[model samples]
Each structure stands twice: as C-alpha cells, then as structure tokens.
Target: MPRAAIEANERMNLRVAAQQKATLMRAAALVHADLTEFVTRAALREAEAVIKSAERIEVSERDFLRILELLDNPPPPNEKLRAAIAALPRDR
Candidate 1:
C-alpha cells in the first residue's frame, strides 16, 4: 500500500546515542531517503527476520525422516484415542 493511503495515527519514540543518530542520518542521506523512512524499513526488515526465525521449525534430516515415517505408519489408536474420536460431532 502507498504511504498516502495508510492512516498515520500512531507514534513511536526511540532514543539513541549522538554518534548513532549521526550515523543513521548520514546513511539516510547517502541513500536519498528520509530518516524515518530508512529507519522504519530497516527496523521492519529485522522484525520480519526475527518473526520468521521464531515461527520456523528446524529439524535435523534424521528427525525429519522419522516424522515422515510415523505419519505414513501410525500406530493403532488406543482406548483414550478411540474415545476422543467417538466424541466428535458426526453431523459435520
């Protein structure tokens, strides 16, 4: 979505060292971007990366094969499992 189309009613404040602020300003100028735009993009990129890392599951190759094997040849349901299945609504 274009920036103009989005409502900007929220505010975020940050504090940084003088040198860090100067560096950010210089980098923004070098890229011909507004400081807010550059910082927002960088922060958003990092946020997405952090979210992806947190949500993703990373299993070893051996564990992955074991998971697939269990799926393909699951054990027979025991008494508790059978009861749970029987409790489900049949009209679905």
Candidate 2:
C-alpha cells in the first residue's frame, strides 16, 4: 500500500510518560517533522523490520548445499511416514 493511503485513513491514540514524550518531540523537531509524523514513521519502520525478520530465513552456504543434497538423494519413507500418508483423507 502507498504510504499516503496507509496514513490517510488511520487513527491511533497513545499515552507515554512525560520524559518519553519530550524525547520524541525533541527528535521530531530536529528532523523538522510534527510529532505524529515522526512517531508514525518510526513505528512503521520498526514494524516493517520486525515483520521482515520474522518472514525471512537465513541459511548458510553449507546448510543450503546440504539441503540440496538431501533433496537430490532423499531417503525412502519410513513406516511411520507411510502410515501417516495412508491415514490422510482422500480428496473427493
């Protein structure tokens, strides 16, 4: 979604300690932004970072090679796995 669209239609309310509010206001001033804009931008940036970290998988080269090798030379399914597959419901 576009930033403008995201910002245009949302309302949020927050409460903070005086010191925290002062700090944020000061930082916002230094960046020449209103308090709401500064807080929104900072919150959005952190939110995106958190979501990206959660959604990403980081694998080392050795592990990647190992995964590929496993795929290429997979072991035969064991009895338990075969039983699980057999237990699965058939599609209509």
Candidate 3:
C-alpha cells in the first residue's frame, strides 16, 4: 500500500543517534515527506520484501522437471493411503 493511503492510527517510537536522525531528516526533506512517513514507508517496503522472499521457491531445472514428471505419472496408492481414502465420509 502507498504511504499516503495508509490509515495510520497507531504510534511507534524510535530513537536514533544524532547523525543518523539528521541523515534521515535530510532524506525525508529531499523526498518531501516527514520523518515518520519516510521511515514507515521504508520499513514497510523492506518488511514486505523479506516476507515475499521467504514465501518464494526457487528450484533448478532438473528439480522442476522431476516435479512435473512425478505429477504426470504419480505412483499407485500405498496401503496407508488406501485405508485413509476408505475412511472418508461418503455422503457426497
């Protein structure tokens, strides 16, 4: 979501070294945003990127092909799988 579109109703407090605060303030000014807005946007963006990276899967071409082959030619059900399927409700 865009920073301007966020319905901010909570408060967050942060403390930084003087030089760091000055740098943040200058950067915020350069972007025509307040310190809180700039920091919130940056932090949210990074947090989203971290989450997205965690949820993504990267497999080599060989692994991908193996997965596709398994799907296309799945093995027959084992005894346990057959028992589990037999136990399912049959009302449908």
lDDT of each: 0.91, 0.91, 0.91
- For lDDT, candidate 1 versus 2, the one ahead is 2
Off by over 4 Å in 3: 1-9, 75-92
For model 2, how does the per-residue alpha-carbon lDDT over 1-92 read when each residue is reduced to its tens digit? 32333556568879999999999999999999999999999999998997788788789999999989999999999999999999999995
RMSD of each: 5.9, 4.8, 5.7
Q: Considering every candidate listed, which one attains the maximal TM-score?
A: 2
Q: Write the per-residue lDDT of candidate 3 for residues 1-92, one digit (tens) a residue.
A: 22445547687678899999999999999999999999999999999897788788889999999999999999999999999999999999
The C-alpha TM-scores of every prediction are 0.65, 0.78, 0.63
| Model 2 worst lDDT window (10 residues) | 1-10
**Pairs of residues clashing in candidate 1:** none
Clashing pairs in 2: none
Model 2: how far residue 20 lies from native, Å: 1.2
- Provide the lowest-lDDT 10-residue window in model 1: 1-10
Q: Model 2: runs farther than 4 Å from truth?
A: 1-9
